[model samples]
Target: MKHSRILSRATAALALAGAAGTAAAHPGHAASLADGLTHPFLGLDHLLAMVAVGLWSARALPAQQRWQGPAVFVAALLAAALASLGGVSLPGVELSIAASVVLCGALVAGAREIPARAGLALVGATALFHGLAHGAEAPMGGFGGFAAFALGFTASTAALHLAGLWLAARLQRLPALAWSFIGAAVGTGGLALLAARL
Candidate 1:
């Protein structure tokens, strides 16, 4: 019933969810719809960044502008993911992914007012890295495998964003305060991932 309790519970839930992520996604296991659905949960970085985007959207953008950022993000993500099929791979994807998580946290924690266009651009830019990472490593099992994998991760990403939005709206205090804590946790997760690779 207390706001602090609610926030703590929410934060713990997110941390537990992050702990459940794996290092890599293998699309060979994603031929089924269920397999694809679980693909985005494969990495903590993906989980944090995706949800952070939604949290940022709810906090920074107005009601009319909220959908734009997320829409652009999804489009940019698809482009980068599809590009990986052509063998256009990015170096330092892990680091880039980690950085994106950090950036997402900063943006959510700050939650400054910004133009919708600028916000959309920011969301789109970071999403490109996340998408490319998944696309490059996606298993080449033909259209069905690729489709399932793509669909799974995409849906999962959307769900995470919604969760972030829900949390942003539900917190009793300033959204930024609750989000700042979440951001800190997500940033910490990114640091751990970066350290693991280095």
Candidate 2:
């Protein structure tokens, strides 16, 4: 029942963000890796999911296994970016990326820990979708710049995850509830981003 409620809310939220721009939307009227570097910051869906990767990693795995989750996500992200560069296309990339935000946030809020292998699979799968979405949005005729953008976004994503991981680690030390609440906030923010589209 609880899962259903969260799913519905997440679904509703994705529906909202669904209407937002479907593309990565960058390097227009300018050409630089800097633009690509800042692209993820341009959208809430991307931003939340990237950071949630970090948060989910911290909460879902043991200390030694934490880095594994982000690693898988990033590797897959790079592959997807390459695929996009090669002119590959996938349907519903935007919606899937948004759904990742919902799922990652939910995982954090629930404090559901799982095996490292399983966690890596989960984050990796979602990351492929995200990579493809970002790749698809790369500026045409600017592989060098787009590569920079890819590097930019990938680096940004890692930083976001690190931020999440660090905060959660600190929060886990406190008696007060912190990480769980932040997860809820992340989920809630995702919903708003989705809704803002409508």
Candidate 3:
């Protein structure tokens, strides 16, 4: 019960912050850099996979391993950017993004603790697909606007990971059913993304 309350409060706080961020990003325009930044957050597959990175990171190692998670993700983002600049033709990028959710969720559900290097490699590879999709999809515009949007999106990703960490911490005390539910939801989101791709 206590854990549930904490989760609820944390979720509420994130929602409020996300709303504020959205408003700041776009005041009148139906679409803007903020929207671009938020595109991933609006999708369950993206949200779950990003959060799962943090959750799995937490479960895999001690607090000292914190940097590993974000570092790997950033590296993946860089790879994706490079791929976009090179005009790499990656087929089924969306499917890969969705599959990331299922893969990461299953890792967490199984409580698998991979080696640090191996884990980072896995995350980096997955991030490539995500980053490429975003890069390819971004509207051509001013570099300044693009930079801002990217920063906002990155910040949002971090926020989501924080939320996931908080939830994971609380869920740790609960029965396995709660964690399994999270995995199921993430996997379902992956399937939805896959179907959309079809």
lDDT of 3 by residue, 45-162 (tens): 5676788787767666577776577668866775675566457758877678767866776666555445766777777787887777666654455455556656666777777777
Candidate 1 accuracy as TM-score:
0.84
Clash totals for all candidate models: 1, 2, 0
| Tens digits of per-residue lDDT for model 1, 6-78 | 8788677666554545364433334555765786676777778888888888888877777666677788888
Best by TM-score: 1
Model 2 error, position 113 (Å): 3.6
Candidate 2 residue-wise lDDT, 39-130, digit = tens: 77777677677777877787778788789877888899989988987989887776666677767777676556455576677788888987
| Residue-level lDDT for 114 in candidate 2 | 55
**2 versus 3: better TM-score goes to:** 2
Clash list (residue pairs), candidate 1? 36-152
The residue pairs in collision within model 2 are 16-194, 17-194
Residue-level lDDT for 107 in candidate 3: 61
Please tell me which predicted candidate would have the highest lDDT against the true structure.
1
Query: After superposition, which runs of candidate 2 have C-alpha atoms over 4 Å from their true positions?
Result: 1-30, 174-179, 196-198
